[model samples]
Target chain A: MALRREEILESARVLFNRWGTAHVSANRIASDAGVSPGNLYYWFPNKAAIIRALFAEWSAASTGVALAGLADSGDPGDALREFVHAAERQPAATARYAFFPRELFALLHADPELAAAYRRNFEAGVDAITTIAQAGIDAGLLIDPAPRANLRDVVVTAWIASECAPAFLEVIAEEPASGRGSGLAGAILRSLLTDEGAKALDERKGARGHEHRGIRAG
Target chain B: MALRREEILESARVLFNRWGTAHVSANRIASDAGVSPGNLYYWFPNKAAIIRALFAEWSAASTGVALAGLADSGDPGDALREFVHAAERQPAATARYAFFPRELFALLHADPELAAAYRRNFEAGVDAITTIAQAGIDAGLLIDPAPRANLRDVVVTAWIASECAPAFLEVIAEEPASGRGSGLAGAILRSLLTDEGAKALDERKGARGHEHRGIRAG
Candidate 1:
């Protein structure tokens, strides 16, 4: 049952990403999944239920990768760089769930249960970012000169920019692939950093570049 | 005829803003406009046509405000400030057309003519911002040490943040009014400013504060 459910979700994700949720009907999803409508319904009550499940899975996977990156890095700058890179990669990582972000507002407004779940996930994401940013500050690798409330606002703003800007721009502008990495988060982070923090971040980037070259040479 | 067209568009905008474009039907819009369905059709062939018209009007108003602010201000810093303020106020200014931003991608995808118009407007907006940023640099009020491409990218990112961040966050997280002024654009702008630029911006802000106080006292 679990395996079938996963298969159904995978099918739905592909269709949703390709054509969006509104265009793809439940029967189409079942056909795409190579399952009878009755079988698909047995596994998932409705398309909304499938979307909810996919959203939960995507959110968990993204948060898990972010937390893992944080846990693996000892240096605060390195951790932050890793976390941001992970976030930058998230759109591609969950491309199957592309429909979710594009239709996010309408979907959430339509389903209270989904909205509540999404809100919890959003809060968790914010908390994780706050923790990482605070750690950077503690390690003397970040400087936020704003008052407490203002600093929090800046962090949240940076978080939103990093997580949503690329995807949002992609959908709205239909921008070329070359236009993808605006590095808005990096710009925001630079504004928040002390000189020491800037140096540390540069050093971390240099080290990562060297590691990448070493791997390529090997 | 034009007056009735305006009335129908206004009615559709309100309904769309309240309940999204997909859920609001043509008949509902016609009823809300206090017009017959035939009359509504005479003005706008369909709901998409009405949405496109509203979008065009909203874009024109926003771009006009930004350009007028730029043209009026002698100081680059002042111009940038005014532009940001105008952009920030846009969501509220066009609140009745909120569905356009929320469903931007889908709407553009659905209509090539609308997509072309939007692309032109977006490019014009970028050009205006770039011109203002360049003026700031020439006046020694901004420092963008980045290469030409990177500098353009940064400006575009800041523009997107200023224009879309509040509306996007409100819809996604149901964030409070306190969260409204994340000042993402301000942060990005600060990062791009030279020391002199930062000081000039501060002085301008201080002067504006005094002006506000003087107005209140008078």
Candidate 2:
């Protein structure tokens, strides 16, 4: 199948989420996917390349998919709910999405081009969030109308890391994860929401059954 | 000379923050401290022992320091600020605290006891946050009295990680010189302060020589 490469990538992501990049060797990935490690190497040169691919793929789907669906919504509160619901759909898949965001953030330690690309995508998502937030204000649903620096990044980045539990790295004495938040997106949102926006989300309780109750938005 | 152990542990904490335990061999820590690795091993059996000492020492100090300070403060918001600020001061030293935490949650591939300890510490911190939150509600500073679940961990963990920006990790992709948001803790505090709290902070802006023009804290 033309999508075989992507499939391997997908499987690699699964293994990575479960085993981390270190333990889930290419040989293991190949075996899990019913291919040879040699075949895996034919596509990816080494462990680092596979990790890079996983990160790139996650960034593509996450920002693009959620923002695309949320773009048309006039109310930022509704848009945020849609996004949360989307994230909640797959506990495992979403876990995959949350899994490596720490390492992805850590790319700044050694690589500039990679960091720029990450910030660009992150900024793009933030822009979309800011736009929707503006809409909420114009629609009488949001409190503040201004775009604060790193507003979305500060919250969203932390939220993703929390969902991933990057703070749990000390047991293995790891880095980067310590540097990131456990997940404060929802709390940060609460601080920024309009009285109306907060009230609206408050009404959605017990609805949608999304399990990401932490992002209660209020 | 009696302070040697504390000094060794302190030096280890710094190296742990930048290099991570796996990357920082005993020699690196010894050299950084201007001591021999042989002396280091004499005090602690292995790096893991040193890791445990760091956690035990920090946990005891942090858990008691601010709680003692805020014991008489009726306002939970004030206590919460004290708590967060205390954490902000030792962001680097605390990296060792999060070293295993990073693995337990982010990687989810660490030893069981480490993960268990992480959960225990995390829950305790959550309890502390919730206690203050409840106090805030009782004091009439907070509107909603009920915390859905883990509101404290989600909020505090996110802020610290985003703000600390650990070494060897790419999580803080933005350039430090850019001076955006001033790490997650300050950003979160600014983002989540109650309207009243924001006003309190803003009232001092002129005298403090800091501007809060567009910063939303409701």
Candidate 3:
């Protein structure tokens, strides 16, 4: 039963990615999953239910894993980069979930329950980034631009900007594929850093470069 | 006839703002407008047409005026601030159009013509900002961060971030009203400015302060 449900979700994700959530139907999802309509119904009551399941799995995989890595990382700057890199690599993992971010507001407005769940996940992600910022401050690697902005707000704003800028620009600007914005997250992060924070980030990048070379040499 | 059309549009905007585009029916909109359904049909054949009209009006009010101002402004820094300030003030002018930014992707996917029109307006807006950036460079008030980052990309990214960040964060984070991120657009713009650009901005801010004081004293 679990295997069958996963199969249905996989099929829905593919279709939803290609045609978007509005155009795809339950029947199409069922057929694509190679399951009888009855069997599909047994696992999922409707198309919305399938979408909810997909979101649940995606939220867990994306935010959940990033939070865990953030908690485990020793370097705050590295953790911040890893978090963004994880989100950046998500497209390769499943381009099918692109609709989630693309239609985020519509989906949330349509489903209050899903919205509530998604909100919790999003908050958790923001909180994780905030923790990293705090860690940077405590380590003397970050300076607070006090009286001007809050550390948490700066970090959250940067994360949201990085995550949404590309998608928003693509939708509104109709930018060419080659013209897609890149490294915006890193740039925003760097802009928020103090001189000390910037130095630390540079050192981390240098260390990572050396590690990459050592691996190749090995 | 024009007055009645405006009345209908006003009514539709109110209801759409309150209930979103999908839930509101033509009948409800007609009744709210105090017009018969026949009259409503005469003006707009369907709900989709009404949405398109709303978008057209919004595009004109929001982007059109800002582009004109950008063209007129002698100072690139002031022009950038004006463009952002105009967009920021729009929520007060008519929060009804919040739906346009909120459901941007979904609306675009559903209506190709609306999408095309919106794309054109968005590109024009970006181009205006790019021109301002070029002017800043020509005046030696802004330095190109070339070999590191593209000025146009940074400006566009900052603009998109500023326009979309507050709404996106509000929706996803369920952030409290008091906890809202403020001055994000200005902060981002400041971050992208060269030292010379930053100094010029500070001097302009000081001049504006004295002008306000002079007006009050008079």
**DockQ winner among the candidates?**
3
Candidate 1's docking class is acceptable
lDDT tens digits by residue: candidate 1, A83-154: 655665665655657777666666776788888887777666667766777777787866643332244455
Instruction: Candidate 3: list runs displaced more than 4 Å.
Output: A64-72, A133-147, A162-173, A176-187, A190-218, B64-72, B80-84, B131-148, B162-170, B176-187, B190-218
After superposition, which runs of candidate 1 have C-alpha atoms over 4 Å from their true positions? A65-69, A72-74, A134-149, A162-167, A172-187, A190-199, A209-218, B137-149, B176-187, B190-218
Q: Quote the lDDT for A150 in model 1.
A: 48
**Candidate with the greatest lDDT versus the true structure:** 1
Error of 3 at B123 (Å): 1.6
Q: Report how far residue A43 has shifted in candidate 1, in Å.
A: 2.3
Clash counts for the predictions, in order: 0, 35, 0
What docking grade applies to model 3?
A: acceptable
TM-score of 3: 0.78
Can you write out model 3's per-residue Cα lDDT over B155-175, one digit (the tens) per residue?
555656655664575566545
Q: Write the per-residue lDDT of candidate 3 for residues A8-119, one digit (tens) a residue.
A: 9999998988888889989999999999999999998888899899999878765754485386477665665455446545544434477787777778777878888887
Which stretch of 10 consecutive residues in model 3 chain B shows the poorest summed lDDT?
Answer: B209-218
